[model samples]
Target: MMRSNAAILVCVLAGSFVMAQEPDTKTLFKEFGRSVKSDDITLSFVLLNNRTVDVLFQAPGKYAVRARANQSTTFYVQGMPEKDMVVDTKFFVEQDGHTYEASSLNIKNFDGNTVTKGTRVDGMIQLGTKLDLTHPFTVRGSHGSVEFVLSPEALKLAEPAPAAAPPPE
Candidate 1:
């Protein structure tokens, strides 16, 4: 009876460990856009992870992506303001059987000076001459990469408004 009880206890503890080791698949949603003098577009989507991220793309420029993980820290440099850390900084989009890459660097100040060392890297790269967010794409950086799929719900978010009915007759 004693040996049987010990075996049962071991099995219970093992099961608990396994359950704790499983990764959590949390989802996050964000939508934002801005215009500086030209046409602007707003993008919204669901991320597969719980990390907070911002995706920005200028009409005639490149895309700037930032992400923060659980272990990120906010700190201030000697002469600079507080900043958050980011990890594994890179971005890539796969469309029409072609892959485009963007290089990322550590976040800097307006004068091109490094503020605080962060796990997240920030940089801009030319996205060619077209911008297509309809297709699925992935954003990768120091922390890691996440693939975003345009679900039916996301499609609705990207839809255009209906035309006016003949100027109300």
Candidate 2:
């Protein structure tokens, strides 16, 4: 039987490796980074599982909220020690003339109707399944937008190397 994901996490944390039911997910973090800027706001994305993206927004502090994406939403707000602040404005993406809104399951800093600000980024955002990384895509919000394509170097970094064979008993 397949081990539970929590069990797998614990085994990995103990410095022992647990082979996955699938070969491709052997690495801890299977993701690639892409970033862009709109005005003074910079947004970075790590496509964590092709569809799940961690969006990091950096901007001036004491900012107000705005719309960034459409559809069901979950937001995260974190305050950096460096005074950098982030607010997840509802965001939307336009690709191939169709609009796709990020669906997030994040409840980290949620406070009733607001996602309370803390010290981090949005680990939510379920990107569109049809998100094309090979081509340029744009992410837009109330302030501005950024357009970018996945870089070959960045993609290469996301490729998982095979795990080492277990040591002698």
lDDT scores of the candidates, listed in order: 0.35, 0.44
lDDT string for model 2 (89-161, tens) is: 4667767777778654443432213322334444445544546556666766653555655567545533444
Off by over 4 Å in 2: 1-43, 50-88, 110-121, 159-169
lDDT (tens digit, per residue) of candidate 1 on 1-169:
9999999999899889865743232311332111111111111223211222322333332212322211221111111223432222234545567777643333333223433532222333233333355676554333334455556644554443244358444
RMSD of 1: 18.3
Candidate 2: C-alpha lDDT: 0.44
C-alpha lDDT of candidate 1 relative to the true structure: 0.35
Clashing pairs in 2: 68-89, 68-90, 68-91, 69-90, 69-91, 78-118, 78-120, 79-118
TM-score, predicted candidate 1 vs. hidden true structure: 0.34
C-alpha TM-scores of all predictions: 0.34, 0.43
The lowest-lDDT stretch of 10 consecutive residues in candidate 1 is: 34-43
